[model samples]
Target: MNKATYQQQFTTEDSPGWLAIDDQLDQIYGDTEPRHYPPLCGLHYAAGGSDPIDGASIYDSNHQEFHRHIVSYGLSELYYDEEKAGGEFSKWGFELTFRLLPFQDDQHDPIWAIQIMNNLARYVFTSGKWFEENHFVPANGPIRLDTETEITGFVFALDPELGKIQTPHGEVSFLQMVGITNTEVEKLKQNPTTDAVKELIDHLKKDNPLLITDLNRK
Candidate 1:
């Protein structure tokens, strides 16, 4: 179909990119329902709120390890738009994904991770810079504010499972967040190379494929 014709018929219901991402999540969750959290006020660019995106949390429990997976819904062209639709890469090219180790007795997904994702979204929206694989950023303090967690920063990596997908908007990459301690963050700041981040992730993956953020890492 011609671009004009396609855009005319496009509606939020016809958001292929959004649907494709949900489908991928459905495949992973199967019959389980993920806990979804939409921004209470609205997106930052529009409403000037703290959170600029929607978040969904899913729990994965197996013999090997158990963790909570959180994914964001803003970072890309989520809906159908002629002007921003169809390109070599999705809106900003990637969506943020995070895996956190869940406490055995935990009853609900940690809201802190969602806040972290929103802050990152704020940085991108305000700075016009996008995050990519191997890119790292300092949290400036404890990743979980007011908490004594050793995780002080994060690095981006292609999600080992979700990886990337072709959407109507373009190529969307699932950039997973890997927590890094103060020492590791310093190493990344000093080197700032893709290989340096890769090595750190490789070391992390030796324990878990999801690369769950270990807050207590010393």
Candidate 2:
């Protein structure tokens, strides 16, 4: 099981902010590869070691793929907000990176990448039901990525042989015993009522009206 690495770069177009970034869709550089560029490029990641996604096209449109990056919505701190630069400026927000480890069939995406994308989904679903089964609920309580500038720009390298990931900055030991899977979620399901599971479900179901609308299921 391999994990994918993603990097987010937040910028503010005013005062020459993000002078080093662009809004292109085909240019980026980091220790690894991003499956696609920004603006809801048809796919995104999610919590747990799940599969890559075909992002809904209602809200974001991969408008500026270059300036778009990854981050944990639950952890993202920055967001764009300005009146003069129109609504497309990349200012007033911090960049984020998500690392979805690589696997045999699917590619890697950054962690928290799903959360960020889901927020986008909420805005898209505002007008109607999603997939005809799940209704849209505006995303809220999302994590911000602004305060993590110091560590958000760093990278982690994989050491398959040593069963760990090493970076010029630091390292994380990969426990081969579990073999990398989303079992964490499955395990959580066993107890149907744990606080941790409820929190996780709440976060995952933020945009899912079908889940939240129910008062008995939870």
Choose the strongest candidate by TM-score. 1
TM-score for each predicted model, relative to the true structure:
0.87, 0.24
* Overall lDDT per candidate, in order of appearance: 0.78, 0.26
Off by over 4 Å in 1: 1-12, 42-48, 61-64, 103-107
Instruction: Please write out the lDDT profile of model 1 over residues 158-216, one tens digit for every residue.
Output: 98778898877788899998999999988889998888888888888888777878676
Backbone clash pairs in model 1 (N, Cα, C under 3 Å; residues 3+ apart or in different chains), count = 0
lDDT of 2: 0.26
Give lDDT: candidate 2, residue 173. Answer: 31
Clashing residue pairs for model 1: none
- Expressed as tens digits, the lDDT of each residue in 45-150 for candidate 2 is 3333222232211111132221223321211112232322222222212222222222222233333445444543343335332211111211222122432111
